[model samples]
Target: MLLLLPVLPTPEFWITLGNYVGLYSIVAIGLVLLTGVGGMTSFGQAAFVGLGAYSTAYLTTQFGLSPWFCLLVGLVITMASAYV
Candidate 1:
């Protein structure tokens, strides 16, 4: 005997929720790489996240790049930045 909530999410809500889950999954994977096996201490997770934000901004505003291409550019830039 369980009660159901009166208001349920619409289709758009479901779509948005799904998108967030996918994005979060990627970020969680990155955290694992940075902390779990790499054993890197993070005083700068926000900086890494900011790098991603800038990459998205630059790709969208400067280059008119697609999201997928922007993601690739961001990954390469982040890895290179970390190495240096």
Candidate 2:
């Protein structure tokens, strides 16, 4: 299956699809770890992702911050929230 991927005519589409699939896989693995290993049952992951997204959006839109700065601020806020 992996070897046949190069045969696709639209490599860009495949790349985009792989990117999304990889991202979802990471989220899924995190959820699995939280539920299976940590014995936690919650949808906190989605909330955290939302918090980061909103923080970045607000910082960039309201303050006209650079993308890198927004990313840093978002990560800081997310980490702080997780700590609390």
Candidate 3:
């Protein structure tokens, strides 16, 4: 009966969905840690995301850094900003 219910999507669809699910799961877990464990009720998680993204953009575009290293720098900046 369950299998008869409109045969599921193709493997590609499942793979894409899995990718997004994993990405969002990690974000949600981070937020959960911030609010639940750290007891910091921050409504600025998106801001942090934007800051990291922009930092990455700046590092890559202006400094001509490798994407991987730029990401590491971005992570450091984000963590430092959060701690401050």
Better of 1 and 3 by lDDT: 3
Off by over 4 Å in 2: 1-26, 36-39
Off by over 4 Å in 3: 1-25, 32-41
Q: Put the candidates in TM-score order, highest first.
A: 1, 2, 3
Q: For candidate 2, lDDT tens digit of each residue in 1-84?
A: 788777856578778898779868977898989999999998888998789879998999998989679978998999999999
Clashes of each: 0, 0, 0
Model 1 local distance difference test score = 0.77
**Global lDDT of model 3:** 0.85
From the highest lDDT down, the ranking of the candidates is: 2, 3, 1
**Every candidate's lDDT:** 0.77, 0.86, 0.85
Q: Which pairs of residues collide in model 1?
A: none
Candidate 3 lands at a TM-score of: 0.56
Best-fitting candidate, scored by lDDT: 2
All candidates' TM-scores?
Answer: 0.61, 0.58, 0.56
Model 3 scores worst on lDDT over the 10 consecutive residues at 1-10
Give a tens-digit lDDT track for model 3, residues 1-84.
546534765577766786679758977898989999999988799788888879998999998999779978998999999999
Give a tens-digit lDDT track for model 1, residues 3-80.
332255447876678778987887788789989989997868768777976897798788888877897888788778
